[model samples]
Target: MGILDAKALRDDIVARLLTDEVDLETSAYLDRILELAEMEEAEHQFLNDPFDRSVALVLQLFQDKDLDPWAVDLSAFLEMFSTRIEDTEDIDLPTCGRLIRMAWQVLRGQAETLIERQNHEDEVDEPWIYDGGWESDFDDNDYNFSVGIITGTHKERLPDMFSGRIQREEGRPVTLGELLMGLKAASRISEEQNLRLKIAEKRRASLEMARERFSGSLHVEDLEGDIRRTWEAMRMRANPEDQTCTLSAISEELADRSMESGTIREEANAEAQVAAMVATLFLVNRGYASIEQKDAIDGSVILTDLHPDESDFEELSLRLHPPPEIEEAV
Candidate 1:
């Protein structure tokens, strides 16, 4: 269809929905358009991008009633959002993040509203019973689901459980935040005042450091550039016979740089080392450096300032195992 024909159809549909009661033909017209859009290319395109089309469909279906938490079928709405798009060609991280954030806000608002309503209802003379409408088909293991239902605190997990249906047989792994929420719900643990104070203290220190870094007197170093510079320096410092440095050596160099330069305290050596390793991995990904496990030494990977050759283009896993202290603590 041409642009004029498309506009006429849209206008007619909107008019029918607004004025008179629409019939099945209206729905059939839309369905037919969607079918034709898939099967044939048109001169005028409404939504050529799959991502745009999917998002438009979501808004068309849910923008009105679904925005009202009370009017929405929470399970179905969340299920639709949680499902992976069959066509992911044009979807980017920012788009995904925004969409996920919107869904999260809606879910959070719904939870708060329901909780407040339940609290108000509890104050009434009549007692209210809850139907397990939010609960999914998963069989409760021991006291997990029962206690959560009784306490009403874990209503947030309803979405997680519902979305977890496909992975039901594999066991839905509880995240750290979910586990913490569960512990708090069961009265096993509570946030201490000292913990909050400590967090505030850390934030204050970070803010001060941020101010110092951004001030005109001091310069904020580019971490990736600094890493590359340090790698080049490492090559220069190495023997002419062996110009390469091990990944562990590079990590130690970064840790020392942070400590000696007073950018970070000596107490954070382990964290600095881990951060350095991660940064170097990013560098490797961007082709700034090449990494390979040394056959001569067990569990040792070497890094070089040389750009990766065509032979190094293939994908491979390079494991960065935890330090002995970290392993022991775990």
Candidate 2:
């Protein structure tokens, strides 16, 4: 009559077949055969105009017959027809029909084989009994899932199933120091951290050298100059301000010196000049040669016999005056 009516009639026939019941009605038998033929036509139409809903219906029909709806051998089907399947916008009608036919063949063959097996079993008088679970029959001596065998002395042992050969070669045990050294060498400390540690060590060494050089016996002028320059250098490197107190202490020492007021003034001037020169040298050594000379020389030299108006010593220069030539002996 129509596709749905034909499908319903075919479904009823298949249901009866599954339950081993038969209907002798000629109208039903004719409808069932006609439905199979109609399905073949529908399958071809599906191939040409694939639709998801239609493909799902065809898939269900094939599955009802216990057949894989995509019945072509996987490799051959993929090579020859997969692109068509993907390109189609409707269900694959031809493939569905082929799948239905294959399912019927397979089911029929299986049924025949099962019938043969049952007939043979019926002839057996004293059938052997099979234990329900294979595992339950196993004894302790049988291969166990839990326990595994280990071989050799505990110190040199390996799993029994391990394929590698074990040797009894004698050797002295590793010493504690050697083991510790190996571990230390393999530790995670980075090269950059090590480099920083080295730099810190060098800076400490340089500071110690400076302390030793400055602490030795020095003329008051030389001592004051060195301490001031050292303080400035430390400051440039962002060293602690506590180091600057060393220079202050040296200044205090110079201030404490007992001398004529004139001599004390002259010595302070000489000390300031020397300090400026030391500071200039320190800056030069540290690669700041372009540092302003005016700043370096400020208040760094002593002047005598100047007017009262020139008493402010802030602007004095530290440039060394050349030694005057001695008069030839008359």
Candidate 3:
């Protein structure tokens, strides 16, 4: 398809993404459109168009939610911090942990600033401040020299960070690549820190929820039969070789069966959907089945007895958005 047609389709899909809260299938459709553009040798024309820039940013945001393009290293950060102190023995667990947390937040802020700069280059009308913490007494030359060293362009002539006002030049803003150096440093420091916080937060929530009482009417006794039925249904319908089935397929299949059996009068009520998900949870916890959700970005889930150990596994949280119920005919 031509770029115009592609852009129209992309816009429609993006609208759905915004309204529907990031449907992975719709995002995948956008991916396919991009691939088509690449195949037709019009990728540059498609991306460089001023009107399509917003679409590109939206697509990129969904594609890379974490957005840590620069690799962060915690050990190097700690070592560098310790070098500033004369007594390395004073470095303790609490101190190191605190520093790690602080560094993580700082990097996150820097990355956010870089992203804002990229998304709104025209709107940023002022000279961006560098938070490098170099002594304020240092001349513009010193700051520029430090930036060059950090960005690995010390040998090459670099632009003055304060060309506009410091040097009394007419108008010269800092380069995007220069701001990107901050991003890269932030990325490096965030690699270890990001995972540490996420794991800790999620684990805390998972444990807390496990201890808390379920306020819902779905009792354990109520789901005993349903859980078995759900498991058996999965075992039967799952691909014989892979023992896998999409979550949507299994849920819909069970819903249809329940409707036929008169267990549910209407088509897939919210109660019935919740029960299905709860039953699936029971099956997974009991080792009768395992879930395969490679990433939340894809938003595709599969029920499988064949557990893939290499894939990153995230604990299931109760985030279900059932489709709108079908209206009854008069």
Best by lDDT: 3
Model 2, CA-based lDDT: 0.37
Tens digits of lDDT, candidate 2, 199-314: 65665565455345333312353543463443333343322322222222323244334233444544453343334334434433533232221223221121111112232222
**How far is each candidate from the true structure, as Cα RMSD in Å?**
27.7, 45.1, 27.2
* Residue-by-residue lDDT tens digits, candidate 3, 15-79: 33232344434543456445544543432234433323323333333333453312222223333
TM-score of each: 0.25, 0.15, 0.26
| Candidate 1 vs candidate 2, lDDT winner | 1
Count backbone clashes in candidate 3: 4
Off by over 4 Å in 1: 1-223, 236-239, 263-265, 295-298, 307-330
TM-score-based ranking? 3, 1, 2
Ranking by lDDT: 3, 1, 2
Error of 3 at 183 (Å): 91
Task: Write down the TM-score for model 3.
Answer: 0.26
lDDT of 1 by residue, 223-287 (tens): 65655544553454444555567654554566676677665543234434434455566766765
